[model samples]
Target: MIKNVEIRQALPADAPAIEALYPAAFPDEDLVPLVRDLQELAAISFVGLANNGLVAHAAFTPCSLAGRGDNVALLGPVAVAPDRQRQGIGSALLRAGLRHLQNAGTGWVFVLGDPGYYGCLGFKPDDDVRPPYRLPEEWRGAWQSLSLSEHKTPLRDQLTVPQAWRRQALWTPYGL
Candidate 1:
Protein backbone atom coordinates (compact mmCIF):
# COMPACT_ATOMS: atom_id res chain seq x y z
CA MET A 1 0.00 0.00 0.00
CA ILE A 2 1.08 3.56 -0.67
CA LYS A 3 1.51 5.59 2.47
CA ASN A 4 1.51 9.36 2.67
CA VAL A 5 4.84 10.95 1.84
CA GLU A 6 5.61 14.46 3.02
CA ILE A 7 6.59 16.64 0.10
CA ARG A 8 8.62 19.78 0.70
CA GLN A 9 11.03 22.16 -1.01
CA ALA A 10 14.49 20.63 -1.29
CA LEU A 11 17.29 22.31 0.55
CA PRO A 12 20.94 22.56 -0.48
CA ALA A 13 21.91 19.72 1.80
CA ASP A 14 19.58 17.32 0.04
CA ALA A 15 21.67 17.45 -3.14
CA PRO A 16 23.39 14.11 -2.62
CA ALA A 17 20.16 12.19 -2.14
CA ILE A 18 18.65 13.95 -5.12
CA GLU A 19 21.55 12.94 -7.32
CA ALA A 20 21.46 9.39 -6.05
CA LEU A 21 17.77 8.95 -6.82
CA TYR A 22 18.29 9.12 -10.57
CA PRO A 23 20.50 6.05 -10.69
CA ALA A 24 18.37 4.19 -8.20
CA ALA A 25 15.24 4.82 -10.23
CA PHE A 26 16.83 4.56 -13.68
CA PRO A 27 19.76 2.18 -13.63
CA ASP A 28 20.79 2.58 -17.25
CA GLU A 29 20.82 6.38 -17.38
CA ASP A 30 23.33 8.35 -15.39
CA LEU A 31 21.21 11.44 -14.87
CA VAL A 32 22.94 12.55 -11.70
CA PRO A 33 24.93 15.21 -13.51
CA LEU A 34 21.84 16.48 -15.27
CA VAL A 35 20.09 16.88 -11.97
CA ARG A 36 22.99 18.88 -10.61
CA ASP A 37 23.10 21.01 -13.74
CA LEU A 38 19.42 21.82 -13.47
CA GLN A 39 19.89 22.70 -9.87
CA GLU A 40 22.82 24.94 -10.73
CA LEU A 41 20.57 26.63 -13.26
CA ALA A 42 18.34 27.62 -10.36
CA ALA A 43 15.55 25.18 -10.92
CA ILE A 44 12.97 25.01 -8.14
CA SER A 45 13.52 21.60 -6.61
CA PHE A 46 11.42 19.52 -4.26
CA VAL A 47 11.87 16.31 -2.33
CA GLY A 48 9.47 13.69 -1.04
CA LEU A 49 10.34 12.28 2.35
CA ALA A 50 8.94 9.30 4.22
CA ASN A 51 10.27 7.23 7.08
CA ASN A 52 12.82 10.04 7.64
CA GLY A 53 14.58 9.78 4.29
CA LEU A 54 14.18 11.14 0.79
CA VAL A 55 11.95 9.07 -1.46
CA ALA A 56 11.45 11.26 -4.51
CA HIS A 57 12.58 14.47 -6.24
CA ALA A 58 11.15 16.85 -8.83
CA ALA A 59 12.42 20.04 -10.43
CA PHE A 60 10.83 22.93 -12.35
CA THR A 61 13.17 25.04 -14.44
CA PRO A 62 12.46 28.22 -16.35
CA CYS A 63 11.54 28.05 -20.02
CA SER A 64 10.27 30.60 -22.51
CA LEU A 65 7.96 30.66 -25.46
CA ALA A 66 9.59 32.23 -28.48
CA GLY A 67 9.05 36.03 -28.25
CA ARG A 68 7.31 35.79 -24.92
CA GLY A 69 9.24 36.19 -21.69
CA ASP A 70 10.08 33.50 -19.14
CA ASN A 71 6.57 32.89 -17.94
CA VAL A 72 6.77 29.17 -18.45
CA ALA A 73 8.26 26.44 -16.30
CA LEU A 74 9.51 23.06 -17.47
CA LEU A 75 8.70 20.21 -15.13
CA GLY A 76 10.97 17.30 -15.64
CA PRO A 77 13.56 14.73 -14.45
CA VAL A 78 11.28 13.76 -11.62
CA ALA A 79 12.43 10.53 -10.00
CA VAL A 80 11.29 8.23 -7.27
CA ALA A 81 13.51 5.76 -5.44
CA PRO A 82 13.23 2.24 -6.80
CA ASP A 83 11.69 1.03 -3.59
CA ARG A 84 9.20 3.86 -3.61
CA GLN A 85 7.93 3.36 -7.15
CA ARG A 86 4.15 2.91 -7.45
CA GLN A 87 3.75 4.25 -3.95
CA GLY A 88 2.33 7.62 -5.02
CA ILE A 89 5.57 9.42 -4.14
CA GLY A 90 6.17 10.71 -7.63
CA SER A 91 2.66 12.08 -7.85
CA ALA A 92 3.02 13.72 -4.49
CA LEU A 93 6.21 15.46 -5.55
CA LEU A 94 4.67 16.64 -8.81
CA ARG A 95 1.58 18.06 -7.11
CA ALA A 96 3.70 19.90 -4.58
CA GLY A 97 5.94 21.36 -7.28
CA LEU A 98 2.97 22.55 -9.33
CA ARG A 99 1.50 24.20 -6.25
CA HIS A 100 4.83 25.91 -5.71
CA LEU A 101 4.88 27.22 -9.28
CA GLN A 102 1.32 28.47 -8.98
CA ASN A 103 2.11 30.34 -5.79
CA ALA A 104 5.21 31.79 -7.44
CA GLY A 105 3.14 33.30 -10.28
CA THR A 106 4.17 30.87 -12.96
CA GLY A 107 1.51 30.75 -15.66
CA TRP A 108 2.17 27.38 -17.27
CA VAL A 109 4.22 24.22 -16.80
CA PHE A 110 5.18 21.76 -19.53
CA VAL A 111 6.27 18.16 -19.21
CA LEU A 112 7.40 15.38 -21.53
CA GLY A 113 6.15 12.38 -19.64
CA ASP A 114 3.79 9.46 -19.93
CA PRO A 115 0.53 10.79 -21.37
CA GLY A 116 -1.69 8.82 -19.03
CA TYR A 117 0.38 9.75 -15.98
CA TYR A 118 0.47 13.46 -16.64
CA GLY A 119 -3.10 13.49 -17.87
CA CYS A 120 -4.23 12.44 -14.44
CA LEU A 121 -2.48 15.57 -13.12
CA GLY A 122 -4.33 17.85 -15.58
CA PHE A 123 -1.67 18.04 -18.32
CA LYS A 124 -2.81 17.70 -21.92
CA PRO A 125 -1.15 17.66 -25.31
CA ASP A 126 -1.04 21.30 -26.36
CA ASP A 127 -0.92 21.90 -30.08
CA ASP A 128 -0.58 25.59 -29.34
CA VAL A 129 2.80 25.66 -27.56
CA ARG A 130 5.44 23.43 -29.05
CA PRO A 131 8.69 22.11 -27.62
CA PRO A 132 12.01 23.85 -28.20
CA TYR A 133 13.22 20.97 -30.31
CA ARG A 134 11.33 18.65 -32.58
CA LEU A 135 10.49 15.32 -31.00
CA PRO A 136 10.28 11.98 -32.76
CA GLU A 137 6.99 11.33 -34.54
CA GLU A 138 5.96 8.63 -32.12
CA TRP A 139 6.64 10.91 -29.14
CA ARG A 140 4.72 13.95 -30.33
CA GLY A 141 1.82 13.43 -27.99
CA ALA A 142 4.11 13.03 -25.03
CA TRP A 143 4.75 16.74 -24.88
CA GLN A 144 2.02 17.94 -22.55
CA SER A 145 1.27 21.05 -20.51
CA LEU A 146 -0.69 22.25 -17.53
CA SER A 147 -1.99 25.77 -16.90
CA LEU A 148 -1.42 26.91 -13.36
CA SER A 149 -2.62 30.47 -13.64
CA GLU A 150 -6.08 31.74 -12.89
CA HIS A 151 -6.55 32.23 -16.63
CA LYS A 152 -6.51 28.96 -18.54
CA THR A 153 -5.94 30.42 -21.97
CA PRO A 154 -4.51 28.31 -24.79
CA LEU A 155 -0.73 28.58 -25.06
CA ARG A 156 0.56 30.02 -28.33
CA ASP A 157 4.32 29.84 -28.95
CA GLN A 158 7.29 27.52 -29.34
CA LEU A 159 9.13 26.60 -26.18
CA THR A 160 12.67 27.87 -25.53
CA VAL A 161 14.22 25.78 -22.81
CA PRO A 162 17.36 26.53 -20.84
CA GLN A 163 20.73 26.01 -22.53
CA ALA A 164 21.27 22.75 -20.72
CA TRP A 165 17.89 21.44 -21.82
CA ARG A 166 18.29 22.75 -25.38
CA ARG A 167 20.06 19.62 -26.56
CA GLN A 168 18.12 18.05 -29.41
CA ALA A 169 19.25 14.66 -28.12
CA LEU A 170 17.27 15.32 -24.99
CA TRP A 171 14.01 15.41 -26.90
CA THR A 172 13.18 11.79 -27.39
CA PRO A 173 10.69 9.03 -26.57
CA TYR A 174 13.18 6.90 -24.76
CA GLY A 175 12.88 7.89 -21.13
CA LEU A 176 10.51 10.24 -19.39
Candidate 2:
Protein backbone atom coordinates (compact mmCIF):
# COMPACT_ATOMS: atom_id res chain seq x y z
CA MET A 1 0.00 0.00 0.00
CA ILE A 2 1.08 3.53 -0.64
CA LYS A 3 1.70 5.48 2.49
CA ASN A 4 -0.12 8.75 2.96
CA VAL A 5 -2.63 7.86 0.30
CA GLU A 6 -5.70 10.00 0.76
CA ILE A 7 -9.16 8.84 -0.19
CA ARG A 8 -11.89 11.31 -1.10
CA GLN A 9 -14.82 11.88 -3.40
CA ALA A 10 -13.80 12.60 -6.96
CA LEU A 11 -14.67 16.16 -8.04
CA PRO A 12 -15.36 17.70 -11.40
CA ALA A 13 -11.87 19.15 -11.43
CA ASP A 14 -10.43 15.66 -11.00
CA ALA A 15 -12.02 14.51 -14.23
CA PRO A 16 -8.88 14.86 -16.29
CA ALA A 17 -6.78 13.06 -13.73
CA ILE A 18 -9.30 10.25 -13.53
CA GLU A 19 -9.40 10.12 -17.30
CA ALA A 20 -5.64 9.73 -17.36
CA LEU A 21 -5.68 6.97 -14.80
CA TYR A 22 -7.67 4.18 -16.50
CA PRO A 23 -5.30 3.84 -19.42
CA ALA A 24 -2.34 3.42 -17.13
CA ALA A 25 -4.27 1.39 -14.62
CA PHE A 26 -5.79 -0.93 -17.17
CA PRO A 27 -3.34 -1.09 -20.05
CA ASP A 28 -4.92 -4.07 -21.76
CA GLU A 29 -8.42 -2.62 -21.63
CA ASP A 30 -9.83 0.63 -22.93
CA LEU A 31 -11.70 1.94 -19.92
CA VAL A 32 -11.10 5.65 -20.29
CA PRO A 33 -14.36 6.18 -22.12
CA LEU A 34 -16.34 4.08 -19.69
CA VAL A 35 -15.03 6.04 -16.73
CA ARG A 36 -15.70 9.27 -18.54
CA ASP A 37 -19.28 8.32 -19.31
CA LEU A 38 -19.88 7.17 -15.77
CA GLN A 39 -18.50 10.37 -14.33
CA GLU A 40 -20.43 12.56 -16.76
CA LEU A 41 -23.56 10.70 -15.76
CA ALA A 42 -22.83 11.61 -12.11
CA ALA A 43 -21.75 8.22 -10.75
CA ILE A 44 -20.56 8.49 -7.19
CA SER A 45 -16.81 8.12 -7.58
CA PHE A 46 -13.94 8.08 -5.14
CA VAL A 47 -10.28 8.76 -5.84
CA GLY A 48 -7.10 7.81 -4.06
CA LEU A 49 -4.42 10.45 -4.18
CA ALA A 50 -0.81 10.19 -3.21
CA ASN A 51 2.06 12.63 -3.48
CA ASN A 52 2.40 11.75 -7.14
CA GLY A 53 -1.22 12.53 -8.23
CA LEU A 54 -4.38 10.54 -8.80
CA VAL A 55 -3.54 6.89 -8.32
CA ALA A 56 -6.88 5.11 -8.03
CA HIS A 57 -10.58 5.47 -8.82
CA ALA A 58 -13.82 3.53 -8.26
CA ALA A 59 -17.40 4.43 -9.17
CA PHE A 60 -20.93 3.59 -8.11
CA THR A 61 -24.33 4.45 -9.55
CA PRO A 62 -27.94 3.75 -8.78
CA CYS A 63 -29.65 0.59 -10.06
CA SER A 64 -33.03 -0.85 -9.25
CA LEU A 65 -35.21 -3.88 -9.66
CA ALA A 66 -38.14 -3.58 -12.03
CA GLY A 67 -41.47 -2.87 -10.32
CA ARG A 68 -39.82 -2.64 -6.94
CA GLY A 69 -38.86 0.20 -4.63
CA ASP A 70 -35.32 -0.36 -3.42
CA ASN A 71 -32.12 1.52 -2.89
CA VAL A 72 -29.57 -0.41 -4.94
CA ALA A 73 -26.38 0.44 -6.75
CA LEU A 74 -23.72 -1.05 -9.00
CA LEU A 75 -19.92 -0.96 -8.51
CA GLY A 76 -17.76 -1.13 -11.51
CA PRO A 77 -14.72 -0.16 -13.61
CA VAL A 78 -12.49 0.05 -10.57
CA ALA A 79 -8.92 0.99 -11.40
CA VAL A 80 -5.70 1.30 -9.52
CA ALA A 81 -2.59 2.87 -10.96
CA PRO A 82 -0.77 0.01 -12.67
CA ASP A 83 2.21 0.46 -10.41
CA ARG A 84 -0.09 0.46 -7.42
CA GLN A 85 -2.05 -2.66 -8.20
CA ARG A 86 -2.17 -5.44 -5.56
CA GLN A 87 -0.81 -3.09 -2.96
CA GLY A 88 -4.22 -2.60 -1.29
CA ILE A 89 -5.11 0.76 -2.80
CA GLY A 90 -7.98 -0.68 -4.84
CA SER A 91 -9.51 -2.36 -1.82
CA ALA A 92 -9.10 0.73 0.34
CA LEU A 93 -10.78 3.03 -2.14
CA LEU A 94 -13.58 0.53 -2.71
CA ARG A 95 -14.17 0.21 1.01
CA ALA A 96 -14.37 3.97 1.24
CA GLY A 97 -16.91 4.06 -1.58
CA LEU A 98 -18.99 1.35 0.11
CA ARG A 99 -18.95 3.28 3.35
CA HIS A 100 -20.34 6.29 1.55
CA LEU A 101 -23.09 4.17 0.04
CA GLN A 102 -24.00 2.64 3.37
CA ASN A 103 -24.18 6.07 4.95
CA ALA A 104 -26.53 7.09 2.14
CA GLY A 105 -28.68 4.05 2.99
CA THR A 106 -28.04 2.07 -0.18
CA GLY A 107 -29.55 -1.34 0.48
CA TRP A 108 -27.51 -3.46 -1.90
CA VAL A 109 -24.59 -3.27 -4.30
CA PHE A 110 -23.57 -5.68 -7.04
CA VAL A 111 -20.50 -6.23 -9.19
CA LEU A 112 -19.18 -8.66 -11.78
CA GLY A 113 -15.52 -9.22 -11.06
CA ASP A 114 -12.98 -11.69 -9.80
CA PRO A 115 -14.69 -13.67 -7.07
CA GLY A 116 -11.55 -13.99 -5.00
CA TYR A 117 -10.83 -10.29 -5.00
CA TYR A 118 -14.41 -9.17 -4.35
CA GLY A 119 -15.03 -11.99 -1.88
CA CYS A 120 -12.30 -10.67 0.37
CA LEU A 121 -14.27 -7.46 0.42
CA GLY A 122 -17.38 -9.20 1.75
CA PHE A 123 -19.20 -9.83 -1.55
CA LYS A 124 -21.00 -13.11 -2.02
CA PRO A 125 -22.25 -14.88 -5.15
CA ASP A 126 -25.60 -13.27 -5.85
CA ASP A 127 -28.19 -15.73 -7.06
CA ASP A 128 -31.34 -13.70 -6.39
CA VAL A 129 -30.89 -10.60 -8.52
CA ARG A 130 -30.05 -11.34 -12.13
CA PRO A 131 -27.75 -9.20 -14.23
CA PRO A 132 -29.12 -7.13 -17.11
CA TYR A 133 -27.60 -9.76 -19.38
CA ARG A 134 -26.97 -13.38 -18.52
CA LEU A 135 -23.35 -13.97 -17.67
CA PRO A 136 -21.35 -16.78 -19.22
CA GLU A 137 -21.54 -19.92 -17.13
CA GLU A 138 -17.90 -19.51 -16.15
CA TRP A 139 -18.61 -16.04 -14.85
CA ARG A 140 -21.75 -16.89 -12.93
CA GLY A 141 -19.79 -16.87 -9.71
CA ALA A 142 -18.19 -13.58 -10.60
CA TRP A 143 -21.57 -11.85 -10.51
CA GLN A 144 -21.69 -11.08 -6.83
CA SER A 145 -23.51 -8.86 -4.34
CA LEU A 146 -23.13 -7.34 -0.94
CA SER A 147 -26.04 -6.36 1.25
CA LEU A 148 -25.80 -3.11 3.11
CA SER A 149 -29.13 -3.58 4.82
CA GLU A 150 -29.98 -5.53 7.93
CA HIS A 151 -32.46 -7.62 5.96
CA LYS A 152 -29.74 -9.08 3.70
CA THR A 153 -32.27 -10.40 1.22
CA PRO A 154 -32.38 -9.49 -2.44
CA LEU A 155 -35.53 -7.90 -3.89
CA ARG A 156 -36.04 -11.18 -5.81
CA ASP A 157 -36.21 -9.29 -9.06
CA GLN A 158 -34.13 -8.47 -12.11
CA LEU A 159 -31.43 -5.82 -11.86
CA THR A 160 -31.47 -2.59 -13.81
CA VAL A 161 -28.21 -0.68 -14.02
CA PRO A 162 -27.40 2.88 -14.91
CA GLN A 163 -27.32 4.15 -18.48
CA ALA A 164 -23.54 3.94 -18.58
CA TRP A 165 -23.75 0.32 -17.48
CA ARG A 166 -26.54 -0.92 -19.73
CA ARG A 167 -24.18 -2.26 -22.37
CA GLN A 168 -24.16 -6.02 -22.74
CA ALA A 169 -20.41 -5.85 -23.16
CA LEU A 170 -20.02 -4.71 -19.59
CA TRP A 171 -22.14 -7.53 -18.28
CA THR A 172 -19.85 -10.12 -19.85
CA PRO A 173 -16.36 -11.06 -18.71
CA TYR A 174 -15.02 -11.54 -22.21
CA GLY A 175 -12.89 -8.41 -22.59
CA LEU A 176 -11.24 -8.56 -19.25
Candidate 3:
Protein backbone atom coordinates (compact mmCIF):
# COMPACT_ATOMS: atom_id res chain seq x y z
CA MET A 1 0.00 0.00 0.00
CA ILE A 2 1.14 3.54 -0.78
CA LYS A 3 1.70 5.97 2.06
CA ASN A 4 1.22 9.74 1.99
CA VAL A 5 -1.22 9.67 -0.89
CA GLU A 6 -2.41 13.17 -1.82
CA ILE A 7 -5.57 14.00 -3.71
CA ARG A 8 -5.71 17.14 -5.86
CA GLN A 9 -7.21 18.58 -9.02
CA ALA A 10 -5.73 16.95 -12.10
CA LEU A 11 -3.02 19.02 -13.81
CA PRO A 12 -1.99 19.13 -17.47
CA ALA A 13 1.07 17.11 -16.58
CA ASP A 14 -1.11 14.46 -14.98
CA ALA A 15 -2.77 13.64 -18.30
CA PRO A 16 -0.24 10.97 -19.17
CA ALA A 17 -0.61 9.34 -15.81
CA ILE A 18 -4.39 9.54 -16.03
CA GLU A 19 -4.36 8.10 -19.55
CA ALA A 20 -2.16 5.28 -18.44
CA LEU A 21 -4.62 4.21 -15.76
CA TYR A 22 -7.63 3.95 -18.09
CA PRO A 23 -6.42 1.02 -20.17
CA ALA A 24 -5.51 -0.90 -17.06
CA ALA A 25 -8.91 -0.21 -15.59
CA PHE A 26 -10.90 -0.86 -18.77
CA PRO A 27 -8.74 -2.85 -21.10
CA ASP A 28 -11.52 -3.80 -23.52
CA GLU A 29 -12.38 -0.20 -24.27
CA ASP A 30 -10.64 2.38 -26.40
CA LEU A 31 -10.14 5.13 -23.85
CA VAL A 32 -7.90 7.58 -25.73
CA PRO A 33 -10.49 10.17 -26.83
CA LEU A 34 -12.58 9.63 -23.74
CA VAL A 35 -9.63 10.61 -21.60
CA ARG A 36 -8.91 13.61 -23.78
CA ASP A 37 -12.54 14.75 -23.73
CA LEU A 38 -12.89 14.35 -20.00
CA GLN A 39 -9.77 16.44 -19.47
CA GLU A 40 -11.22 19.12 -21.71
CA LEU A 41 -14.79 19.28 -20.38
CA ALA A 42 -14.54 18.22 -16.76
CA ALA A 43 -16.10 20.60 -14.31
CA ILE A 44 -13.97 18.92 -11.72
CA SER A 45 -11.28 16.27 -12.12
CA PHE A 46 -9.10 14.87 -9.37
CA VAL A 47 -6.09 12.60 -9.00
CA GLY A 48 -4.47 10.76 -6.13
CA LEU A 49 -0.72 10.62 -6.13
CA ALA A 50 1.42 8.13 -4.27
CA ASN A 51 5.16 7.99 -3.78
CA ASN A 52 5.70 6.39 -7.18
CA GLY A 53 3.10 8.24 -9.25
CA LEU A 54 -0.63 8.75 -9.71
CA VAL A 55 -2.66 5.94 -8.22
CA ALA A 56 -6.24 7.04 -8.80
CA HIS A 57 -8.33 9.57 -10.77
CA ALA A 58 -11.93 10.69 -11.15
CA ALA A 59 -13.77 13.25 -13.32
CA PHE A 60 -17.08 15.08 -13.50
CA THR A 61 -18.32 16.67 -16.72
CA PRO A 62 -21.04 19.24 -17.42
CA CYS A 63 -24.43 17.85 -18.41
CA SER A 64 -28.02 19.04 -18.61
CA LEU A 65 -31.59 18.11 -19.42
CA ALA A 66 -32.87 18.75 -22.92
CA GLY A 67 -34.54 22.14 -23.61
CA ARG A 68 -32.11 23.60 -21.07
CA GLY A 69 -34.26 22.80 -18.10
CA ASP A 70 -31.74 22.06 -15.37
CA ASN A 71 -27.96 21.80 -14.97
CA VAL A 72 -26.12 18.67 -13.79
CA ALA A 73 -22.92 16.72 -14.15
CA LEU A 74 -21.80 13.17 -14.91
CA LEU A 75 -19.32 11.27 -12.76
CA GLY A 76 -17.45 8.59 -14.49
CA PRO A 77 -14.40 6.46 -15.30
CA VAL A 78 -13.13 6.58 -11.75
CA ALA A 79 -10.02 4.42 -11.93
CA VAL A 80 -7.19 3.15 -9.78
CA ALA A 81 -3.88 1.83 -10.99
CA PRO A 82 -3.84 -1.97 -11.29
CA ASP A 83 -1.34 -2.29 -8.49
CA ARG A 84 -3.20 0.17 -6.31
CA GLN A 85 -6.68 -1.27 -6.19
CA ARG A 86 -8.53 -1.54 -2.84
CA GLN A 87 -6.14 0.77 -1.05
CA GLY A 88 -8.82 3.50 -0.60
CA ILE A 89 -7.23 5.81 -3.19
CA GLY A 90 -10.21 5.49 -5.54
CA SER A 91 -12.62 6.29 -2.74
CA ALA A 92 -10.60 9.30 -1.68
CA LEU A 93 -10.45 10.73 -5.20
CA LEU A 94 -14.19 10.20 -5.67
CA ARG A 95 -15.05 11.92 -2.42
CA ALA A 96 -12.83 14.88 -3.21
CA GLY A 97 -14.30 15.35 -6.69
CA LEU A 98 -17.87 15.00 -5.45
CA ARG A 99 -17.29 17.49 -2.68
CA HIS A 100 -15.86 19.96 -5.16
CA LEU A 101 -18.89 19.62 -7.42
CA GLN A 102 -21.32 20.06 -4.55
CA ASN A 103 -19.51 23.14 -3.33
CA ALA A 104 -19.58 24.59 -6.85
CA GLY A 105 -23.41 24.73 -6.76
CA THR A 106 -23.94 21.93 -9.20
CA GLY A 107 -27.55 20.86 -8.66
CA TRP A 108 -27.29 17.19 -9.60
CA VAL A 109 -24.80 14.47 -10.46
CA PHE A 110 -25.38 11.14 -12.18
CA VAL A 111 -23.37 7.99 -12.55
CA LEU A 112 -23.65 4.50 -13.97
CA GLY A 113 -21.62 2.18 -11.84
CA ASP A 114 -21.54 -0.47 -9.19
CA PRO A 115 -24.32 0.21 -6.72
CA GLY A 116 -22.56 -1.52 -3.88
CA TYR A 117 -19.65 0.92 -3.88
CA TYR A 118 -21.44 4.09 -5.02
CA GLY A 119 -24.42 3.61 -2.73
CA CYS A 120 -22.17 4.10 0.25
CA LEU A 121 -21.43 7.58 -1.09
CA GLY A 122 -25.12 8.65 -1.22
CA PHE A 123 -25.86 7.51 -4.73
CA LYS A 124 -29.30 5.93 -5.22
CA PRO A 125 -31.77 4.92 -7.84
CA ASP A 126 -34.97 6.89 -7.80
CA ASP A 127 -37.70 5.46 -9.92
CA ASP A 128 -39.11 8.97 -10.33
CA VAL A 129 -36.07 9.89 -12.42
CA ARG A 130 -35.00 7.94 -15.48
CA PRO A 131 -32.28 8.30 -18.10
CA PRO A 132 -33.08 9.11 -21.73
CA TYR A 133 -31.75 5.80 -23.00
CA ARG A 134 -32.87 2.25 -22.43
CA LEU A 135 -30.88 0.40 -19.81
CA PRO A 136 -30.59 -3.29 -19.14
CA GLU A 137 -32.67 -4.67 -16.29
CA GLU A 138 -29.61 -5.07 -14.15
CA TRP A 139 -28.60 -1.50 -14.86
CA ARG A 140 -31.85 0.09 -13.84
CA GLY A 141 -30.96 -0.15 -10.19
CA ALA A 142 -27.39 0.86 -10.90
CA TRP A 143 -28.23 4.23 -12.42
CA GLN A 144 -27.98 6.75 -9.64
CA SER A 145 -28.27 10.47 -8.94
CA LEU A 146 -27.05 12.84 -6.27
CA SER A 147 -28.63 16.18 -5.47
CA LEU A 148 -26.58 19.09 -4.17
CA SER A 149 -29.24 21.80 -4.20
CA GLU A 150 -30.73 22.95 -0.92
CA HIS A 151 -34.31 22.43 -2.07
CA LYS A 152 -34.03 19.49 -4.40
CA THR A 153 -36.50 19.22 -7.24
CA PRO A 154 -37.63 15.82 -8.39
CA LEU A 155 -35.48 14.78 -11.35
CA ARG A 156 -37.36 14.75 -14.61
CA ASP A 157 -38.45 11.38 -15.91
CA GLN A 158 -36.84 12.19 -19.22
CA LEU A 159 -33.11 12.52 -18.76
CA THR A 160 -31.11 14.37 -21.39
CA VAL A 161 -27.59 13.00 -21.24
CA PRO A 162 -24.99 15.14 -22.97
CA GLN A 163 -24.80 14.70 -26.75
CA ALA A 164 -21.09 14.16 -26.80
CA TRP A 165 -21.47 11.08 -24.61
CA ARG A 166 -24.38 9.57 -26.52
CA ARG A 167 -22.19 7.81 -29.06
CA GLN A 168 -20.39 5.76 -26.47
CA ALA A 169 -21.95 2.33 -25.96
CA LEU A 170 -21.28 2.23 -22.24
CA TRP A 171 -23.29 5.41 -21.82
CA THR A 172 -26.23 4.17 -23.89
CA PRO A 173 -28.01 2.69 -20.88
CA TYR A 174 -27.57 5.90 -18.91
CA GLY A 175 -28.58 7.91 -21.99
CA LEU A 176 -25.36 9.89 -21.92
Flag regions of model 2 displaced more than 4 Å.
174-176
Lowest summed lDDT over 10 consecutive residues: which window, candidate 1?
Answer: 167-176
After superposition on all C-alphas, the RMSD of every candidate to the true structure, in Å, is 1.9, 1.7, 3.1
TM-scores for the candidates:
0.93, 0.93, 0.87
lDDT of each: 0.84, 0.86, 0.77
- Which pairs clash in model 3? none
lDDT of each residue in 1-176, candidate 1, tens digit only = 24667888999999988887888887986778778899889899989988888989989998888856858999888888888788787887888889888988999999987898899999998778888888777887899999998888777879888777866656765564
lDDT of 2: 0.86
Please list all clashing residue pairs in model 1, or write none if there are none.
none
Order of candidate numbers by lDDT, starting with the best: 2, 1, 3
**Residue-level lDDT tens digits of model 3 in 25-81:** 778776667778777764468889888588888888787766475778888778888
RMSD of 3: 3.1
The superposed Cα distance between candidate 3 and the true structure at residue 3, in angstroms, equals 4.6
Clashes in each model (backbone N, CA, C under 3 Å)?
Answer: 0, 0, 0
